[model samples]
Target: MLARTLGALLCAGLLVGAAQARDYRYSDAHLHYVDFFQETEGMPALLEAMDKAGIEQSMISGIPVAKKWHEDEPKRPRYYAGDDADAYWYSATDSYVAAAVEKLPPEQRKRFHPFLSGINPVDKNAVAHIERMLELHPGLWQGIGEVFTRHDDLTALTSGDTPRANNEAMTRIYHLAAERDLPVLLHSNITSKRERNPLYLAEIEEPLRNHPHTRFIWAHAGSSMEIHRHQEKMDFLLPTLTRLLEDYPNLYVDLSWSVLQPYLLDDKGTPRKAWLALVERFPERFMLGSDVVGRFSSLGEQFQGFAPFLDALPEDIAHKVARDNFLAVLPKPR
Candidate 1:
């Protein structure tokens, strides 16, 4: 009778422990402080949402370029590339992010890490522009990008020259990133949503192969919100990510909201075994992101959505994906 009672108590204690662990605080690996359409809720609102969501820190950047209003529609896009005007480099967007960060008290400011995102990645002058921003900001910026290279509709909308990950301009930026020990958060879509083929694989692959020293966080593991909206399933995502993780030590995937569907969880909302195995095999290579743009209310739901997957993981690995892994990749404070 005593043995039975003791066993019951131990089981109860273990369950409680697991429940507590599920509420892990996060260091959001991907987020945007401003949007192309000027739709941000501003800093105080963002901080409140973060506090509610238990996000201890976040990687924040401005949209590097602004989406123009397509003349046929001549209205602001309800979503990314909704009407599809050309995208052009807008440096002031980065300044908005910088000024927002500057407003916080030093103690509060430490919780936010800002990245430079305003440079036109295709322009040869981009290298000089980035260098100028770095010199202007001193130690204020922590990393570079959320750089959009192969976005679904947005890539089609970009005017003049489209940016490619392996372009000579990006090559120079990669060299600078290596020199400064800054990680680059690149958003190059792996494939188009309709085709679901790894069509632009080489764009990101070349940079990974060439710039092995520069830490590259592949946003959404190369998936996008636009893709998620159009396609209910992502068939090729797992194998492609597995190959990349195997091939490149410098590559880390941003498993944000778009990846949660079909990749992380199945139709019934159960964690997929293959993905679990991949996370287990390369536990340090994956990180979580809310991918929230210009707003903050959904932040809690975004982090909470990963609970099922995290619960399936070993406690340590769950904690790492939830928070620690992101902190690990951050540029060490100078």
Candidate 2:
């Protein structure tokens, strides 16, 4: 009787291990590790959430701009499109814009800078911290990612009076990324005919026109504008997804925070089909992004929002979106 009981337990353990092995690579391409969440909660909190969700890794992007989120319209970052495409919006405040100007030597300051909303002062301490984080917790970034621009920053820089400031800023960040070989996951939404979003499109289109080596994963299926929209989100998103994937190969899309996300589903809502269909079209060309906004006010809601979305996905596709696809892009598993 004792031997039989032990044998039964052993079999159950083996089955559980096998089931876990059968699971696909679970990754989340877009995550916010920044001011609101980072200072208080930090990356460990995010990792805990991942463990529960069975997320093996995540392309965690910290906010590029600290306080400078594109808080306004016309001056909003050009990298964002849709209704404000024609509108002149700034992603951050005017005073905040001057900070990046400080990064350049006096002589070099003549050329306009690029960034959607604002810039982060290169903190020797923070870079040291980033380095420490890597050294102390080697493989901490098995799937961590570039935080890219906060939404507000993208607005201001892209809406600049100058032509290529936003592109130039991206190039600067891209240069840094190329140096570290970290595939930073920036955010962009393409709906507007003009503004920083279109400017962002031009920034990459012109440079990568022939190179074909440049690759970027568009977060949120290029619908950052839909975050606030209730009924009209699909109206704004579907067409954009089709247009973007058709154009950029070095480009991929992540169906982050889509209207079809599971939690968003309730009684009358059924955006899942459209979301799945979009993923079906570009199964290989997409990843997952969960740009859960983390401000003091919204922190509670932002906490662990992506877990449910992960649970909601079919195992196979969810595995790809969550982990495997991102690994294909990383230079080394940090």
- TM-score of model 1 (CA atoms): 0.91
Worst 10 residues of 2 by lDDT: 110-119
Q: Residue-wise lDDT of candidate 1 within 265-311, one digit each (tens)?
A: 88888999999999999999899998888988999999999999999
Clashing pairs in 1: none
What is the lDDT for 244 in model 1? 88
What is the lDDT, from 0 to 100, of the residue 145 in candidate 2?
34
lDDT of 2 by residue, 111-209 (tens): 221122223322223233334444543432332233333343344444334323135445554444455555545454443433332334543345334
Worst 10 residues of 1 by lDDT: 75-84
Best by lDDT: 1
